[model samples]
Target chain A: MNGDLTVSAASKDTLPTVFGYIGIGVAFGIVGKAAGLSPLLVTLMSIITYAGSAQFVIVSMLVTHSPIFSIIFSVFLVNSRMILMSTTLASYFKRESMVKNILVGTLLTDESFALGMNKLNYSDNHLNFAWFNTANVISYMTWILSSLVGAVLGNFISNPEKFGLDFALVAMFIGLLYLQLISDKSINFNLQLIVVGFVLVAIYFGLIFIPSSLLILLVTLVACSFGVVMKHAFF
Target chain B: MPSFNFVLLTIVGTGVVTWLSRITPFVLLKKFQLSKGVVEFLSFVPIAIMSALWFENLFVQHIGHLPSIDWANLLASLPTVLSAVISKNLLVIVVVGVISLGVTRLMMGM
Candidate 1:
């Protein structure tokens, strides 16, 4: 770990995330356009919403003419995970000013949050505000711009599937999941990974009955609690 | 065309909900002290959440049924997962996965 990698240099580390965002953003744009949304409208939605999955859900609901209340409810349900993520990230930004933290928190997406946390974990510095903000800002910009491009060219590429853009976000998530694993020599780390995997798979199976958002929230709480209990009892 | 008011409401409503979710914890947790046990356990949240997301996307189709395996995605993910294990680089993983899926789609003539 080079201690000399300044915050600016660390910001460049988000370039890969930038690519992932653009891919997913374009997919969203294409879908939005196909759903009869104007390019300007979708771009505005991206700017304000800034959430990929939620935007996708919103667009699909719009197409179906679902009630606005349900659209709002579904987006909230999908994005409720942000609450957990924000809480985790809050502990890290304890020293920063409230305004800056709020600004940074608005741009939090799953990829950016995971990558930002990973960088912080591996780095020696206490908290590199510039690096974290740069990563978030770049990710947000890339997503908005790419989505606008996709909406504009929505007519050109009738099938985003032929290009396999749908898999980009999933691939990115897989990479992120791989990155989150700590390669330490601790047995507890491995045990935690196994527990998380087991819990997630169980939740997946449980989805047949439990609503996905509620199930995921329940699983997170239970899994985290189990981790606490296990650490206290054994580790 | 959908009514303009409905569209506007959709955007504004979604924005409000999204912002509220993101802001609540930042406001509530800032002045509070969290327990060590809780923080330690929260470390695993990312892995748990990401796994749920990746698997849900790869496997699940809809509500109230078993996730039928999509062979194209499954076959394509094989190389992608292998590359992910080998290289923690996001670019490498995405390129490998996209190309793998593209070739599979081509062969299957879908």
Candidate 2:
């Protein structure tokens, strides 16, 4: 080995993710702490679950005293996209050992997976487990630390809602929803918006008619089907 | 403080389910193939879920009555959605949304 430090392409694109995770992580922490969770629990969530939106949903659910099974279902639904990511990654990991696949899979995230896939498709980066895991670990540690910072910061705020900390989750979702809309270049902007508008209206009515715990899952399923059907019908 | 067990279970349970979903495709889906239709449908899940979550929190619902907008959040959403569109950055959008909401709440004498 030359002993010269070389930044793997897998890790190079992680700078944006570092900043992204910290902001979201801290927001999650403040929101969690605002909901009466211990700072330690907030940090543990960052360390363990590591999914941003899902964590927010879980915290809000906990505040409402939702059933435990319902909370788990929310996690599963929010994170089901990981299945698609893992499926795409499986092709790349075929030659690697099962142990490596297992370990790497555990660390898979939207940013890291996107980085690895983008590099594989266009760049010359050698995506070894070391490089891949390095990306995940960096964000992983950053998330936990940022969440702790927010949790500690949250202690000083007498009323989170007054400070708009409660709106943080909703704001984050709005941002994320926009991100999702643009992330997939395959789908045109207009079409995605139509679907979003449809889903929003459905959820509004669904909230009134159906049990929310059940409505969320059903709406997601129905909306996706509607999107697929519309996509085929249009394009 | 919430019951220690409930908090622990939620965290651990979510972590398990999340990790399992991340790894399941590697160990199990390797042998099978997902149809293109299924993948397309899956792509829409995030959009649908995010929209649902956003709308759910944006309004205050009443049984047998249409949900009314939470004016504070709705007003705050003006800037939030704008920053999200203009900057297209999560951190920026969040900062804008938080500051805007905080200001709105203050000005409204909330």
Candidate 3:
């Protein structure tokens, strides 16, 4: 009975995270179409690319008729973060079979990482691999299908911009960030405020010196390192 | 440069890069264990990167000038943020943000 209850509770926590990926996936699809990519191309990108920010950047480049080499470089730069994500997972997956590890690595995304990391927190077992794979598959299917739907129907809609569908992506990220904020409730409000201020400053400066993707990486690393150092020093 | 060839090259190029970024770490780390400090630093990378990305989108202009305060993006972001705070469900927040932006744009004669 206790085992069953635990399983049920775990599923409850994970189910919403899975569904969130679906919604995010759909939003990506809609936005991809608005950016002028074809449905087939959008689907292929979702399947092949899997990283949301990279996909968005790719579509933006496509709409602007960027050269092929530029698009490739931009995608490479945007996805550089995945190297960190996969590396972290490597430590936890030391015991898993090679095939399983490769499959999971291919499906790694922010949502999948969150779910997998949360599960890893509770158990020392390898079964978290299965859960991670399951969540990724669910998220992947939702993203692909929703993107296909958006691509096919996107043309009929005369004005997606008017409806503010573009804001969907922003709102989704905000919601995800809110969750991160709440999880670390002990964080000082004053420090949080300062971090926000610094991010804005970074954004202003980042626009001048670097591409948006790299700017994000640079600011995040600097700010987060500061936050971590402060936390250790003070608390 | 045929379109079909362009598509094929994109797929292959992206695939190769993606696979290498993901696979290389595992292969290298398999032989050597990561130090505690390294692990701790890596754990924070995602949150930092995501924040930077989100902040950039919220503030930067995609096309010409930064979108005006009167732009659909600014007008729509208001409701979208509200919906996210209230619902906390991805679908609800997305639908609300998109629909609200659309309706507001129509009303504003944009």
Candidate 2 chain A, run of 10 with poorest lDDT: A1-10
| Tens digit of per-residue lDDT, candidate 3, span A1-235 | 0112144444454455544455456666777677766677778877876666677676776667678787778777777767877887887777877777888788777666654544443454233456666666776777788778777777775454554655555555555555544443346655555565676666666676566666665776677676667656775
Q: Each prediction's TM-score against the native?
A: 0.92, 0.71, 0.77
List chain A TM-scores, every candidate, in order.
Answer: 0.90, 0.67, 0.75
Q: How far in Å is the alpha carbon of B66 misplaced in model 3?
A: 8.6
Runs with alpha carbons beyond 4 Å of true place in candidate 2: A1-38, A49-139, A165-173, A176-183, A211-215, B1-10, B63-65
Recovered fraction of real interface contacts per model: 0.60, 0.73, 0.47
Task: Flag the better candidate by DockQ, 1 or 3.
Answer: 1
lDDT of 2 at B108: 92
lDDT of residue A4 for candidate 3: 21
Question: What TM-score between 0 and 1 does chain B of candidate 2 receive?
Answer: 0.72
**Candidate 1 on A19-41: residue-level lDDT in tens?**
67877899889888988999888
Interface RMSD of each: 1.8, 4.2, 3.8
Query: TM-score, B chain, candidate 1?
Result: 0.87
Tens digits of per-residue lDDT, candidate 1, B1-110, equal 48767787789889989988887787777788888766786776777777777766655545788656677887888898899899877789888888888888988888
User: What's candidate 3's DockQ score?
Assistant: 0.43
